[model samples]
Target: MIERLSIIGVGLIGGSLARALRAVGQVGEVVGCGRSGPNLEKAVELGVIDRFTHDPGEAVVGADVVFLAVPLGAMRGALSAIKDRLDASAVITDGGSVKGSVVADAVAAFGKVPTRLVPGHPIAGTECSGVEASFAELYRNRRVILTPLSETEPDALSLVSRMWEACGAEVTTMSVGHHDEVLAATSHLPHMLAFGLVDALARMRENDEIFRYAAGGFRDFTRIASSSPVMWRDICIANREALSAMLARFGIEMTDLAESIRRADGDHLLEIFERAKAARDRYVDRVK
Candidate 1:
């Protein structure tokens, strides 16, 4: 159990983690730190945290664990802010979608990667933002991937893994490279496609009517397009190498599919549809 926990960004992911730990009685004194004062006030009012601070350095004081839930773009600044104030033995982890950039940021900010710092990403969330959207059950039955470097302290990794497990998440560990490649294909690529499809349709003629007539399929596929653009922009840039490779392969496949459709190749279209349906059907239940 943790005595004091500091969360650098008290948004959906951070606030939800706080609530989850509170729900299990595994944590005490959650101090939320964020750029938005009003949002921090709201988190306090909602009982997501015991107190609030606008400064990351002040928030980490006396805390045994620090969780950085800020956007990928804000991570370096947050780390730099808390660098000198970090307790020598405090375990630090993050909810960044891209692990490589976070590891690099830690190295840059601290002169080297701290053995107590474990990079983690919880594979769960809605297309929502802010502390108000947080819930304790957000991570229930979800996977939380922890990427530990060779120098990472075993005790520190154990603390982080057990903390996530207490929050109802299945904790798993993998190399940072493997984690980034897999997430780029599974999560980032889908969000990119969803955003691209929605933006493309929005720019078409009679876009208003197009949206007005859009059905369940359109909404379901594009739901993630409603996610925070700033966060996604950073994610794309941070994981650009892996994400770009996936995007290139997808682009080639789309071009071939379009050409086949333009040629009125019903057989080709049927084959593609059948293959996709079979694949999705096999894995859709796992997602659900």
Candidate 2:
């Protein structure tokens, strides 16, 4: 049972956590922190947090649990700002998509206290952002990945896991490296491809009709391209190694398909298309 929880960077992820935690009675109070005064004020007005502050120190004081929900690039600064104010027994966690860098930063910033840090990535989000866009049930039935290092304290891990579970998340544990690698293929690479495709087409004056016809397939594929540039940019840089490897693999696969099409190799094309269709059908059935 967390008596008090502090959420740094109270945008979509942070605000949603605060709201969901409160809805499930997982915490006695939720304090929000953000660099923007107006965003903090809006969060309070929206009741996403019980209290709001620009000072990370003020937000974290006496908190039994703290969640760093900012962009991956802002994480180090946010943790440093609140490190001194964190309760010695407080369990610090993050909602960062990449965990390896965040965990390393935590170790460097807090030294021995890093054992209390639990890095998490909730595979739940919309193309939306800000406190106004937050939904209390955003985490419901969603997967929350906890990348706990070998040195991470079991008690601290348990506390963080319980909090996410209370928010209606299905929690799973993975190594930081493995989490980054898998997410590179599933989430990061796709976002990169979407943005790249959109940007390439945007350079053409005749492509205005593309946006006009962006309903159905185009809409679904480019949904993630509409995500916050700041957030995605940070994620890309932070998980550069894993993302680069995945991108290289993706390029090889794309080349194979392109060659097949160029050669009019019907059998090869059919094999690739059939496998992709079957995989997608399996995933859809399981999800349903």
Best by lDDT: 1
Stretches of candidate 1 exceeding 4 Å from the true structure:
none
For candidate 1, what is the TM-score? Answer: 0.98
lDDT of 2 at 127: 95
lDDT of 1 by residue, 1-288 (tens): 999999999999999999999999999899999989999999999999999989999999989999999999999999999998988889999999999999999999999988999999999999999999999999999999999999899999999999999999999999999999999999999999999989999899989998999899988999999999999999999999999999999999999899999999999999999999999998997777
lDDT of each: 0.96, 0.90
Per-residue lDDT tens digits of candidate 2, residues 1-288?
A: 689889998988999998898787777888888889888889888888888888888899999999999899988888888888878898899999999889877867777548889999999999999989898899999999999888889999999999999999999999999999999999999999999999988887978987787779988898899999999999999999999999999999999999999999999999999999999999999988
- Model 2 / residue 59 / CA error / Å: 1.3
Worst 10 residues of 2 by lDDT: 104-113
User: How do all models score by TM-score?
Assistant: 0.98, 0.97
Candidate 2 stretches greater than 4 Å from native: none
Clash pairs (backbone) in predicted model 2? none
